[model samples]
Target: MRHGVQLLLVFLVLVLAVPASVSASSEGGHGGGDSKKKEKSEKKEKGDKKEAGKAENGVITIGPLVVNILSNKGYRFLRLEMIVECADNEAAERLVKADAKEELILMLSNKVADNLLANSGKMILRKELIDLFSKYTGPDKVKNLYFAEFVFQ
Candidate 1:
């Protein structure tokens, strides 16, 4: 009778302990999963912010302008056909009216801006022109710039 009671007590203890252990392990796993989900959501939000920033940085457009400039070295002249993106449509129109190619050559020769490749140069020139135009307009109106077509000779 005593041995039977001892065996019953041991079984009861094991049953109780097993449920507590399982509950503790399940809670821990759930907590870890929740933390991982929170971290993933935070990372996704950061990625979204970066994408928004990039979108806000510039506007893209096509161009059919001929830019003729005398190079820094007096003997060489570069003629380029380029596609440009402006911070805004106003800037784009201004660029067209001012003849960006001519302005770029003058700006580069005068050291106001650096000479760059067809694509990069157009982007830089677009920004520079936006800044120039913003002086007459307002900076809040300007965003970013890009280039779609560029040809250099």
Candidate 2:
């Protein structure tokens, strides 16, 4: 009788302990996976904010036209701000006299200027733009373009 009682107690303890151990291990594994996903999402958010700041600072002026070109996957938009920089002060004076705002908007709306953006050939197109801009304005004047806000339907 004594031996049978001891054996039953041992069996009960083993069954309970095994399930507790399994549940603890499973919960820990799930927690680790969740943390990793959260970390990845946080990093992505930080990168996006940095890109936006860079885009905001990318404003440039040529003659009397202030230009902020946003390059997206398929298209680009030139946001005109205020006239600031020019090749020559006299050219700046002429542009200011000629109503540069209207001209800039018209040129952008009509797509008269080259897009300098490509869909199927992104890398090659980027390299081409860099090369072209460098020839005219030197490499230091040209940098990469980014789309701060993008919407696709």
Candidate 3:
């Protein structure tokens, strides 16, 4: 009886250990194939990032800008909300460190006012505003601009 019990234990240990060794060897053989799949996925991720135009670091949403408009009849106003996409983490940090919110407000306000005055109260188009800001900030530095809210009064 003692001899039979010892044999059963040995057999169970071998059965457990054999499958683990087989799986480990199989995994090692397949390791080389994973590199190609990894490379393809990495390439796909790069392409997706470019197409999305997402900031590598993040994005900044700048304000509900309230500007008084120049109108012939009465006091007109323009309110706008804008999102600024920075080139990367460094650029976004620079923007905050420079205290550019006020400066940006002034510059953007001037641009909008200039358009309104030139057209005699014709509001500026979203695309034109984006282009103007891109020019001001340098297209390389600012990835893109988005209008979250726009109201003319």
Candidate 4:
């Protein structure tokens, strides 16, 4: 509470100081002298916003999910990571909030090492996982899926 009040006071001081400085600078023609600087600042701010927008629409990783799967010899370790391309950022966030990691763990645990290590098996697993996650992302909301990491031991 004390820190909050101090921060508020500092904010108020800065706010009150800015307009006074601006008015004084304009009166002295100093503000006009710094027009280019202001333009640069504005451009920098716009660039920052564009970067943020791209981040929102960027790739979202499901998990570096580590699970145990059944094998002919015994239980084996499976470490998998996936990224899903979504129709929109909101759909991507939904996939995360939908608790898909737990579902993936269960799905992976039922697999065998031989199937996972094989190309056909990996493709099948990818399709099944996509279909499972599509429940949360909505129909055709998932644009694509990519395996960032897949390790079976």
Candidate 5:
């Protein structure tokens, strides 16, 4: 009876060991295919992201702007460089060729003078300036505004 029990235990061990070894060998053989597939999918996804990011946002760059701000009868100043993002190719082209670009800058400068440089403007947030530009310039014309260079004095 004891010998029979020992033989049963050995049979169970063999059964478990055989399947585990077979599965490991199979996985090792096919592992290269799985890795290659994963790599291809990752590359495709990265390409898609690059295309989407480029197509949706077109960059428009302009010269730097330097302006003075007056707060509480003290002299405060801001020198800023800016870039505008346009929604599409046409808007980007218009932004490049449009005569109203200077006018838009003038309007933004006025907004800064009225809101930020005057009175208690030292506590103003940078978002306020971005909002001012966005408010004065229609959303159709400008997708987003970025301050590439900003200095406060």
Candidate 6:
């Protein structure tokens, strides 16, 4: 009687494990067919579109901004991708019209690497940039400033 119960338990385990293993194999083994690969790619594309929409809700992206750094190396270049956040889309529009990029480029171009390379220096620079952006977009218009890419050499 105990052996019969053990056999029943093993039978139930097999019943549950088969479907799980089959589904796992189907989801992970895209090499099985073109259709699986196509389905996975489609899901990825949908996710990317949703993320892009969310990420730029009240943000303006500006970049490949190249400025001459006031370094001892006879002015090295700093390439940046700046992302600015605002109260809303209207503020973002105002930021663009107020020549925000021009002001930022001018401000950074006048700075030495020592004023920007350290963590504390970067924090100070972020605050300064936010203030400069606010000045350009008008009081209370700009919310935050981010460096998507900061490369100096």
Candidate with the larger lDDT of 1 and 6: 6
lDDT of each: 0.51, 0.45, 0.60, 0.79, 0.57, 0.77
1-153: candidate 5 lDDT, tens digit per residue: 999999999999999899766765676664565677789999999876543212235565554566655555565566766666766655554543345556545544554444654435533534454454444445555666666876666
Candidate 3: global Cα-lDDT?
Answer: 0.60
Query: Estimated TM-score per prediction?
Result: 0.34, 0.24, 0.42, 0.61, 0.39, 0.60
Which candidate wins on TM-score? 4
- lDDT, candidate 3, 1-153, per-residue tens: 999999999999999999766765575655555676689999999876542222345475555668765555554677877666777655544443334555555555554444554434443455555555555455677776667876777
Candidate 6, residue 31: CA error in Å?
26
Winning model by lDDT = 4
| lDDT agreement of model 5 with the native | 0.57
Order of candidate numbers by TM-score, starting with the best: 4, 6, 3, 5, 1, 2
Q: Please tell me which model should have the higher lDDT, number 4 or number 5.
A: 4
What residue runs in model 6 are displaced by over 4 Å at the alpha carbon? 1-55
lDDT string for model 4 (1-153, tens) is 999999999999999999878875775565664676788899999876543213156357766778989999999998888878888887777766537766768878998898777789899988998898788878988888899999877
In the range 54-122, model 2's lDDT, one tens digit per residue, is: 123334333323344444444454443332232333333333333443554444444412343345343
Candidate order by decreasing lDDT: 4, 6, 3, 5, 1, 2
For model 5, the stretches where C-alpha displacement exceeds 4 angstroms are: 1-57, 96-99, 111-141
Candidate 1 lDDT by residue in tens digits, 25-120: 675754565677789999999876533112222342323444444554543333333333446555444444445535555654443122655546
